[model samples]
Target chain A: MSKAEIKSPLPGMFYRRPSPDSAPFKNDGDSVSAADVIGVVEVMKSFHEVTAGIDGKAIRFLVDDADAVMAGQALAEVEA
Target chain B: MVVRVLNPGLSTTVQDLGRPGYFHLGIPIGGAMDRLALRAANLIVGNDEGAAGLEAVFVGPQLEFTRDALIAVTGADMPIKLDGEEKPSWTALKVRAGQVLSFGFLQTGARIYIAIAGGIDVPLALGSRSTYPIGALGGFKGRAIAKDDELPVGNAAGGREGRSIPEALRRRPGMPAELRVLPGLYWHRVTEETHRNFFDDQWKVAPEADRMGYRFRGGRPLQFVERDQPFGAGSDPSNIVDSCYPYGSIQVPGGTEPIILHRDAVSGGGYFMVGTVVSADMDLIGQLQPNTPTRFVKVDMDGALKARADRAALLDRIRSVFA
Candidate 1:
């Protein structure tokens, strides 16, 4: 297995969950597929989905929820 | 010429100088966030200063032109692309009948203005093509452009290619952008400490910044001066009897985060405003990237008028030079 990083295409506050009250799009340590939504980056009030680009497992969140992130910043890591 | 939206990108809408005289009716001006940039793009392409153009944020739209046309891209530092070839921004370029126009990722600012030889031919609602999306009024059926949507372009108005706006005429966000503010009538509501700290702190533009308003964070929470809860004013210390919100008014909803209402500002709101950003500095706010640092500089009536005159002079310069 190998580790891969998921990066955000847009600069904004990264969110683990779709909404404050909802469960996260993907849980920490969950197995993920290439197109699985891991989080969202809210840019200037608009939410854009961030997806895992590779099949992986044991996903570990790198950035905390609601933390400001720059473009191309790594959001999470996954074991492939 | 009609252009087909091949990919509508993030958020692209048609806008002009905006519809005024309707703010009292709860319709905001709702034009391009950066009016100067919009005008520059239009001017560079030989269109009317108030011509309707495409305003894209973060990303740029891909459009295939059905007929030859001249175009100009301005505002953000995004590289323009025509049929996959790189083109310079703020310079008028010609696109063949089949050429597709696109843009690269934003390098500095947040919005880009795309002006064609002729203006976007969307029907005007209440005298303008600016989109007021919240109200479902004006511009390309009153919403953001969508993929596969065919946008009508006005007849060509004899714009020449290769015309460009000079570098000095372009406006960009500053290193720690400064916004001049005029304390509003409600400035008396906040404590003395808040008055000093509000201007003292360097605030960051929150992720929630948008056309409606720009929110700021990392500022100290405010303390309101004790006062009897006037009738109709809510219980929250920051709440006031709903009052007309002036464009650029800085409202503290819960005495915490400050939101500066912009072009699409609501006509009335319950929050208390500490001050309003001077009109001259308002356009630059639209170019600020999220998380960018900003400082509020206090200004009085004389200063505000002087700044307005200076801004108008700059606009006049752009007009004359382009003309």
Candidate 2:
């Protein structure tokens, strides 16, 4: 098994869920794929989705919810 | 010649000086956030100062040019690479046909401008090629440029290769950018303490900074002068009868974070404006990174006008250096 990281494409605040009241996009042990959205990065008031980019058996978030992040900052790690 | 978009980087858009004279109808003056950078890039490529060009925020687009042409990049310190060959930024360079141009991660500032010789030949809407995405109005299809799009380019007007702006001419904000404000019509609404605190405390650019407005945080909440609710305004003391938002007006909603309207600001809103940032510093605001520390400097009417004149002189100097 190998672990892949999900990185933010742009800098700003990162959110695990679509909205404040919604469930997180992924849990610590959730399975993910290249097309799966792991979180959203809010840059300059615009929201952009961040995909996992790799198929994995389990995912672990590296950054806390609503935390400030930079471009290419690792957001999560997924084990394949 | 034509330019092909290999990858449309985040929020890539065609913009010039923007369409004015229509904000009354709810359309904004939507254009490049860093107008000075756009103008500098265009001048380096020998295009009109306000020629339509690409404005990329943080991430720059990968573009493939169809023919040899001069191109210049300005604003953010995004490394310019042509077909794996690194090139100097802020200087005009010649690219051969089929050569691809790309950029590295943003090193400084928030946005970058790419001015091709003769400019991007997008159809103008309301006298501009700027994209007003919310209105679905101008620019390359009235929206952000998408991948695989072939954008037309005009013939170069004799731009010289290697033309570059001087180091002093390449403008970007210093650490802890200072934005000067002129207290406005509703400035009296805030209590005396709030007024002092607004300028006394240092604030950080919030993540909500954008073309429309920049929200500032890390300051004390505003305290309004207690009074009976004004009619048509909400119960919040910060509420007001909808009034025009001047280009740079600083509005505080619910007396919390302060939001300074920019080029694409709404025509009017229910929030009260405490002041307006001077025109000279608006470009600096555009280049600021989110979370950058900032302070508000109070300016009188004379100070504001002098700052405007100083800005004009700076532009004049830039124009003459290249002209």
Candidate 3:
């Protein structure tokens, strides 16, 4: 299996779940399809979803939940 | 041509230069928060300087073109994509029918301006297409656009595709901004110590900011000079006889936080205004993001006019590029 990395498109605070009370979009080892939302980046109080472009099994997230991330920073690794 | 709104990200509204000469009638001069960006977008698409366009805040909208048309996105560093392919901003590009134009996470700044070859064809109110949602007047049905709203496009003026603005002309985000203010009208209400604090200290933008006004927080609370309340002036120290408010007026209620009224602010209010943001720097206010630190620089009328002239010269230089 080839590994792929999902990168953040913009700089913001990364979140594993949609909100504070919600479950994470995907857990480690979970399977995801193309276009499946993996996380969200909150900027200027607006939230934008980060989606997977390739189907794969979720690996570990590169950043912790609520950590500040920069544009093009790798968020998570996926095993295709 | 027609454009369909697939997703109205945040508050997307159609705005132009705005209608002047109507403030006396109790109508606010609601228009584009960043007029410089709006003009740049229009210039890229070969439209009039004041042509109507979409002002997307923080997030941008998902727009599907119904026909082939030329478009340009300016202001804010929000990444834009067409048909799922990333595209550059501050440049004109051609879009085919059924192509979806969407945005990525905001990189910097707060709003993005999207201009088509032909401006958004909406019924003009008071000689402008700008939206004033408080009064529910002008723009697309006088409100922010909704998903699935089909907006008609006017005739294209024919601008060259692939035209890009010079790098120096673009306003980079994340840079500290200094907005020039002309202190006047009720300036005497605040104590001298507060006046010094207002100019010397950095003020952080509060989250309560919006199209109506940008409220800032920082420094010691300003105190008004004790005086007997005049007739029709409320008891609050910040309150005065309800009067006309010029665009960019800064009013402090309870003297705790200062609110700089913007393009869509109310025409008249009882709040005490200590200063008016100069016309040239109003665009800078639009680019300010929440929690960003800013400083108000005091400038005289001559300085303000000079700044305005300098901006005009810069715009002229940009126009020469396209000409």
Candidate 4:
């Protein structure tokens, strides 16, 4: 099966961790379970959590922390 | 059945429920502003909820039915005639071949929904039949109905079943304006006094309103700490991020006139959202025309959720009538 690539549903800045000084959720090739918080999407003042579903390993990070992203922009690739 | 357009009215077009899952492509979810009336008319004629129908605004065109068909009129109480005789509202009626369907002035509400039994035969675009005039992608050439235009109807099922629409599915005559809103993402940005002033004041629907957004007058400009600043896609304090904005988001641009984003609004925007018109009260916004005075009442999250659930149940009840 093809790996599921996760993308941001809205435009906003991408954050590796919920806040600064915190460790990232996953590094390269880090295995993650379904519903794992992959990242956070902050728009205006609202912060929405982006989760990795159905268990997968982070194969690549397509977006950097604090980088502005548009809606539907792919953020990460996950391999089951 | 076929209907010849004597007049197109104001921006009339075929529409379905709406176009979802395309906001990522900057596509606005264009469709019938009054989904309740649209679905009700469709259900009356045994059409699917997603069936294409005519969305007429303010006044509709004079058309002659070329073939016998079943139709229902709902939403605004537009003076309609089955060949010059006045007809009732929110009820299904049979129109014989050659009967001219003409509409008079609107008594209440701005939009009037006309759902044909076989459904307005129109090709689907991006998984929907809604008309997005901005993108010129859906409906008949992605524009409003015009004079002398011949509209095609989905063949068959026009004369097969003549079913009676249950009374429970019928809605009473609607008022000019009454919208319920949930506090927006930036509701707290304005002072509590300003927030109080929002619902307390009466706002008139500006003449500049359209499918894209409804500009309102009378309400004081919502003040913020800074007069002007760079706003990004997201409402975050640091970075302006772009996000898929759903329908009913009240976009306040630089403390300008409050523009209530409607069905044909842009996918994403750069502005401060004061609040959103809750899902239950979306149709109320749809019916507001130029110069209509409307008041915004703040609804709590729980109340908003309950209202949405109630509306869903009501539609479910209407859908079950045929089942």
lDDT (tens digit, per residue) of candidate 2 on B1-323: 88999999988999999998998999998888889899999999999999999999879999999899899999988789999899999999999999999987777788989999989998889999999987888988888899999999987899899989899877788888899999999888989998899999999989988888999899999998878877898878889988888899999888889998887788997989999999898888888777788999999999999998988888898899886
Candidate 2: stretches off by over 4 Å: A1-6, A17-36, A54-62, A76-80
DockQ of each: 0.53, 0.52, 0.15, 0.01
Backbone collisions counted per model:
0, 0, 0, 17
Residues A1-80 of candidate 4 have per-residue lDDT tens digits of: 57887876434467889779999977768888878888886642456687875687655788898776554567888787
Query: TM per model?
Result: 0.92, 0.91, 0.83, 0.73
TM-score of 1: 0.92
Q: What's the alpha carbon RMSD for model 2? A: 2.5
lDDT values for all models? 0.90, 0.89, 0.87, 0.75
TM-score of chain A of 1: 0.95
Tens digit per residue, CA lDDT, model 2, A1-80: 77888888787899999999999999999999899999998877679998988999789999999998877688999898
Pairs clashing within candidate 3? none
DockQ, ranked from best to worst: 1, 2, 3, 4
The window of 10 residues in a row where model 3 chain B has the poorest summed lDDT is: B170-179
Pairs of residues at least 3 apart in sequence or in different chains that clash in candidate 2 = none
lDDT of each residue in B1-323, candidate 3, tens digit only: 78999999878999999988888887878889999999999999999989999998877899999999999999998888999899999999999999999998777788899999989999999999999987889999999999999998999988988998988998543445688999987999889987887898788776567788888888578878999989999999999999888889999888889899998878897999989999888898887776677888999899999989988997898788788
Candidate 1 local lDDT, B1-323, one digit each (tens): 69999999888999999999999999999999999999999998888999999998777899999999999999988878998899998899999999999876677888899998889999989999999888889999999999999999998788888988889988777989999999999999988999999999999999999899999999889989999989999999999999999999999989999999998889997889999999899899988888999999999999999999998998898888876
DockQ of 2: 0.52
Worst 10 residues of 4 chain B by lDDT: B232-241
